[model samples]
Target: MAAPGFLEADGRNMSRATVLMLMAPFFALVIFAFLYPLANLLSISVLEPQPTLEHYQRVAENPVYARVLFRTLQIALLVSLLSLALSLPVAVLMANSRGPKAIFLTACILLPFWSSVLVRTAAWAILLQRNGIINQTLQFIGITDEPVRLLYTQGAVVVAMTHVLMPFMVLPIYGALRNIPADYSRAAAICGAGPLRTFWEVTLPLAMPGIIGGFILVFLTALGYFITPALLGSPQEMMIATLISQQMRENLDWPFAAALVGVLTLIVTVITLAFSKVFRFERMLGGRV
Candidate 1:
């Protein structure tokens, strides 16, 4: 038989054990579902064709893969920048407004997310097709006499991607802006800084973390985006993701495909770490503010 104190301790231990047991499924899911596959891909990249470095050497030597990788980074960077430009004003408007107006503005930004990605891409395709509604409307309104080619281009991909990614950019920045004290702006005004100056100096600095976070988020996601670019862009504008799919499916080269995945993973990790380091430095400067 146990003493009263011993019994209570045992009960507490059991309770803690029960909580941990409840969380085991999540741990297992991450380990098996996500981590296992990643490990397999990494191993496959190196171990294929008798554990040689030939695949990586080929990737480095080949201009086609190099070009696709470059194009992917370029497109991703462009999309992120465009998303930032479009999201800042919207986030500011939402962060400042209140009640029904703020709600309406927020809904407008979030409404597109409720729909399917395929649905959104299809809609854009229809709108941008040579004889689609946009061209027809343009002709009707006398913007252009002839239907112009718009369906498959780099610009079309960027526009559709920006539309999809805008909310990711907006929400983080909005949260950052909302957290900033109104007093900062008030003080700026007292110090003789006009609205533009206040924005450029005081507000923008404080909001940098969120803007950086949003940019990184959109930028990284755009890097792996297959469907949007596949649908909206042509072969000349093909991205790394599409190339990876082509390698695995069309070419039936698992080793090379795995190498592509490995390279992409490395690139993403480097970029994310670089951004995280920047964020941490800014936080040090911020100091509990």
Candidate 2:
């Protein structure tokens, strides 16, 4: 008979091989679909036109590109913060409620997802236009003498983006809040802590993982956001994605557009790394280390 140790080793090897075989299709898809396209983008950015760095140099030197990049970061941060603020109360409500109340709240939150993003944005345009419902309501209420220029402004872009992204923030936070044992809060109350104090001290810290995850999700999605900003914002309010689209389509500057993409990709990589280092992402996603 084979030695027990040798038999155990052989079984382990077979298990490892089976796992790898199961994962082969996923790895192949990632390589061809994602890594290959990214490699092409990086190559075109620097290797096109005889290995020149002038494309990147122009992006660095140009004031327009810098402004747009800064604006994109600003808008993304704003949207993330706004989404967090709006989501917290709703998440709390959902976490604490049960039965029909929970169902109703969930339905309200999910109602927006049934529609396309373009349709949602167009709805905002109708509500914010000069003679639209919002302006008319304000006029009827005597808040303003005439129609306000609500559409095609930075505020409009921020508001619409916040509304669109709020669901992403709410769901993560709700999950986090729901996972906390009811005993913890009861323990706090027994320890003479008021409701507000118990929530601030016990509840918030436990729910932080969800909050961070939500913030990162909203911020990253907003960074590459195109349609909402494009429709609602003016030329002066253009974000980096819009600039990249203009460069690619209107100017037909493929290499330059690739360089712009390279810059944005670098920024995203840096931000993701920084967040990972500062927080335990495994915990944030409710996984054990």
Candidate 3:
């Protein structure tokens, strides 16, 4: 018979092999669906037209591309901040409430997801139009002599994007807050900590993981947003996504577009790595790193 130690090691190896076998299909799908397309994009950026780096050079040289990229980053960051600020209170409410209140809050957050993004964006456009409900209300309340230019502006783009992405921020935060035991807060209170002090010292730190995760989700989504920005923003407010769309459709410059995508991909990868390092995400998720 095999030794006990050897038998246990063999069993562990078999389990590992079985797990890998089970995951093989998922790995294959990810490779074909995501990695293959991404590799093709990178190859096109340099390898097309006799392996020239002109597309990347052009992107580096062009101030216009830089401006669009900066604007995209700015908007994405702004949306993430706004979503975090708005989500905190709502998530807290959802976590603290019971029964009908929690259910209602959850339903409200989820209701928007049931509707299409285009429809939600269109609703914003209608509300923000020169003579639309918001402007009309402003005029009625004597806040302005004329209709304000709320639509086709950077603010409108930001606002609409924040509305659409708020759920992503809220849900993760709610999960984190919900997971926190009530006894933790009670323990803090018993230790002579006021509500504010308890929250500041205990709650916020514990919720950092969810906050970071939500911010990442919102920021990344905003980075590639197309419809809301296109519908609500002017040419001056064009983002990197709009620039890419323009290159692909109107300019028909596939190589240049691929270069743009490669740059964005690089930035995203860098940011993700930086956040992972700085935040120690595994620790946040209660894992040993």
Please provide, for model 1 over 1-289, each residue's C-alpha lDDT reduced to its tens digit, 9 standing for 90 to 100: 6334433454554454555777899999999998899899878879977888889988899998899999999999999999999999999999899999999998998898899888999999999999899999999999999999998999999999999989999988888888889999999999999999999999898888788888888999999998999899898889999888888899999888889988999999999888777676444222234
Tens digit of per-residue lDDT, candidate 2, span 109-196: 9999999999999999999999999999999999999998999999999999999999999988888999999999999999999989
The regions of model 3 sitting more than 4 angstroms off are: 1-14, 280-289
RMSD of each: 4.8, 3.9, 3.8
Best candidate (score: lDDT): 2
- How does each model score on lDDT? 0.88, 0.91, 0.89
Q: Give a tens-digit lDDT track for model 3, residues 1-289.
A: 5334433454544454556777999999999999999999889999988699999999999998999999999999999999999999999899899999988999999999999999999999999998899999999999999998999999999999999999999987888887778888999999999999988999888888888888987888899899999999999879999999999999999999999999999999998888888876654442221
Candidate 3: worst-modelled 10 consecutive residues by lDDT: 280-289
Error of 2 at 172 (Å): 1.0
The backbone clash count of each candidate, in order, is 0, 0, 0
In model 1, the runs with Cα more than 4 Å from the true position are: 1-27, 281-288
Sliding window of 10 residues with minimal summed lDDT for model 2: 2-11
TM-scores of the candidates in the order shown? 0.88, 0.91, 0.91
